[model samples]
Every structure is written in structure tokens, then in C-alpha cells.
Target: MKLHPTSDFRGLPPAEDALVRYLCAHAEALLNAAALLGDRPAVRRTARLFEELAETRQPLTRRQHAGIRDLHRLLSLEGVDDPDSLEAACFAEIDPASPVVEEICLLTDGLASRLAALRQAEGQPFGMDLSAAA
Candidate 1:
């Protein structure tokens, strides 16, 4: 995905705009790392998912956010001997100091919090109630 400037965020509400920009940047970072990692299966999977999400050019649904988070956690750098070194190498080519891991963490955390807030605003609890089941 082509990296979009913050100005392109027009039309989206402030919060959604920020989220979209962050996700785009995250996608670009992961995709660049995937490109340098060659044909590894995990990298390929992550690249595919990021590409799909980037092409959407819209805010991610909760399920899509969860899927990407899982892929990032489980497959983004799987089997890499030293992910920091790999990230450094990739970032050197794309962005010299773009901290992929931290960005991903912040983005996922923010999204999760936003979802929780939305649920709360709608009068829904954050999680299931075991007492009801019992």
C-alpha cells in the first residue's frame, strides 16, 4: 500500500482518521519486513493479510482487527532468529527508525480500548458473565 499522508485523512472523524493512518503505517512496515524476509510462509501470510487490509482503505472491523493482531503476534516474525535484527535491516531500507513492534502494540491496544469503550457506551459489558452461565 502506498503510504498516505495525514492530509488524506479528510472525511473521516478525528479518531477514525487517526486509527486509519496508524493502521496504514503498520501495514506498510510489516509488508516491507515481509518483503525482505523472502518466501517464508509466515511472512507470506502476514503480507497477504496486510495487503488485503490496506486495500480496503477503511477502518478495520473488530474481527479484522483481531485477525491482524493474531497474525502479527503469531506469524509476523515467526522463525526469525532475531526479530530485532531483522526489523532493523528492513527498517533501514524503508524507515531507519520505525519501531514496528511498538507501533503494532500501540495500534492494537488503542483499537481494543476503543472497541471496549464503544461496547460500554452501548450498555454492553466488556466480557461474558460467568455468573449467568452458572
Candidate 2:
């Protein structure tokens, strides 16, 4: 799959825009991984989530924002000790010589880095508690 550049999220607050972009990119990566895994159901579900996020301008609640962070962490293949998880399994099947997998990995890494930078600039700690707002 060809990786597209991030979309310009106009008419959204900076934070909301960042969150939406992050979710969209994350979902895109999941969709690619699902394709590689031949999991049609995952592809459909992730595609729906990506479309919903791309079209919505609604502000994310604290919990939803935290969910993004958690999901990003779950999808990250770096430093994970679990061998049976989806991320690990997908990564295990990836060929180091394959450009598609490499592109997906790079895109995912870039998105995660961008999200971390956005959180830092907003004075938010990584994985900050959202329950406090409940």
C-alpha cells in the first residue's frame, strides 16, 4: 500500500486536529497490517474508524484522547516483550527487505513522534491520567 501524506485538518482546534490526524494515521497503519495479515474484518473495522475520524470535527474528551495514547502504545512494535500480541505478530511476519512494511513502520513511528511532540508542547505528560477529569 502506498502511504499518503497527512491531511490538512482545517477548521479544527490544534489539539483536536492533532488527535484526529494521529488516529487516522494509526488506523491507516492498522489497515495496512490487516491487509498483510489477510484479515478482512480488521481492515473493514479500521477503515470505518479512519473514515469517522477523518470526517468528524468534534472535540475529543479526555478519555478519548487517552484512548488514542493507549492505542498508539499498543500498536507500537518497539521494546515490546510480548510475542503473541497483534503488533508483534504482524511485525514478525514483516520482511526486513520489504519496502511496504518499512514504509508502514516509518509512518507509524513518525506519527507517534508527532503526537509526543504535540503533547509536550501542550504541557501534557506522556500517558497523563484522564480519570482525574472524570
Per-residue lDDT of 113 in model 1: 58
TM-score of 2: 0.60
Q: For this target, which candidate reaches the highest TM-score against the unseen true structure?
A: 2
| All candidates: TM-score | 0.39, 0.60
Q: Rate the local accuracy (lDDT) of all candidates.
A: 0.49, 0.57
lDDT of 2 by residue, 1-134 (tens): 22233665676667567657665655656667555543454466555556555555555555555554444554465424566655566556778798876766766676577666666656779665433321
Locate the minimum summed-lDDT window of 10 residues in model 2: 71-80
Cα shift from native, residue 101, model 2 (Å): 3.3
lDDT of 1 at 88: 41
Clashes of each: 0, 0
TM-score of 1: 0.39
Which 10-residue span in candidate 1 carries the lowest summed lDDT? 125-134
lDDT of 1 by residue, 21-77 (tens): 555656655554455543355477665554555455455455455545445444234
> Candidate 1 has which clashing residue pairs, if any?
none
